[model samples]
Target: MDIREDLRDVSGQIARLLALSNVFAENNKYWAHLKNDEDFNRVYRIPEKDRYKVESIYADGRDMAIYMMDALAEINFNYARYPTLTSIIEGFQNTWVYGNYNKETPDIAKEICSTYDIDLWSVRQMFKLFKDQEKLLAAVRATLAMLQNSNLYKEENGMPTQEKHPHQINLTGINSSSININSDGASAAVNQTYNEPAVFSEIITAIKLQGLDPIIEGELIDNTHMLAAGHKSGTFKDAYIDFMQNVSAHITVFGAFLPALSALL
Candidate 1:
């Protein structure tokens, strides 16, 4: 499998989860089936495959897998997003077409109609003359190119300012849920603990599995510039917050690595 492609797909899920984690939208199925573990699993299951891949860091240990699940389930994230909506869309326009805009590249109809006072019949005729007529008649769509980007990195000491930013790095691991066990003799509840050491080990192994050097990744993250909304018109804090949020979604894979992301540091 292409690692970058996989990462890009994973990144989209993180973005959605970041938006839905605390959502109260009545129609959202995430909350609708949340009480039914099976249903919740169904809705959130697409990325579970990726989680299984990450679980390889544990080398197929059932206990480690259990711990990993517990750790993920317990996390309450202070999520952030990167390449803000503005930046990602801008990047799309810039790259998708020379501009190479996929959808934004204006259609012949729009460009020509704007300059002429032509009637509907004339407009239809004009379109018939254009080659690749189907493309010329296609609907407007945002390429959203930033979604495929697998290039993300961070550097030491260059982290965004502490007070203004949410705890992007200083994650909190709290086991807020519990599982009930019923044995022949008795029933018991267990509080899953966040095993920092285990999580740290897994993170290192998982990153390496991508064939990336953490040291180089750190540098790349620090120096890289992806599109982020609000940066052009907003304060540094706003831009940083947007980038960090996107990063949160990019790395978390729903809930597997979050809260324990503190282990990354």
Candidate 2:
């Protein structure tokens, strides 16, 4: 048995494992951020004199990534079910860097919510608007506020599940003073005044902050992405049509505004 061949085979396996991990990371937009190229060079402190040490550092990284992805997949699967408080979160032990989840939603998600006495359907609806963790959390805070303010959902003790005030909307850093929802469910009314004139820069900033990637000028741009126009009413009209037809958010505030605006026009 050639020992050199065995060493080469081991190196190849490590390389292959690392390559697959990278592909998965990219495909999922999963930024593991385990460490960057410079960090590896600095930590290992491999001198230029010993070129062979490079493979050793890479092999170590390969092993670390394998473990990181494994943990991330497990955690993400758990979060996929969300809207429920899980003891699993307590058990987690994150290191300096945090792992992201992007795995097939576990079959137990529904069951997990059921176990926690969480409303599965409502949770789904929440996720429909708030896709990521941060927004989801903010929305949760807002929903609890709605529930508490509704004068409904009272336990025998008569305590509130959601506290009043601290109501957040869109949570993209715009906490408008006028936007208030104290009613119940979708019918909950937002009773406030809007004397502040619409500032173009503010609207544009808000859109960009959402990472909506708005196109300002008319171009042969793909109709899929949301586009804004300075001129060419045709392009604007086309984009609006595409958005309305594809995005079924009629229940959303912005969605409701579209039809209302159309009627007014």
Note the Cα lDDT for every prediction shown: 0.28, 0.28
- Candidate 1 at 43: error in angstroms? 62
Top TM-score: which candidate number?
2
lDDT of 2 by residue, 166-264 (tens): 332221113232321222231211123212122322333433444443432111122112222100111223223333333333223143244322221
lDDT of 2 at 252: 39
lDDT of 1 by residue, 131-191 (tens): 1111111101111222333232111224342332322322345564321111122211112
Total backbone collisions, model 2: 0
Query: In candidate 2, which residue pairs get closer than 3 Å at backbone N, Cα or C atoms, i.e. clash?
Result: none
- What TM-score does each of the candidates earn? 0.17, 0.21
* Clash total of candidate 1: 13
Error of 1 at 73 (Å): 39
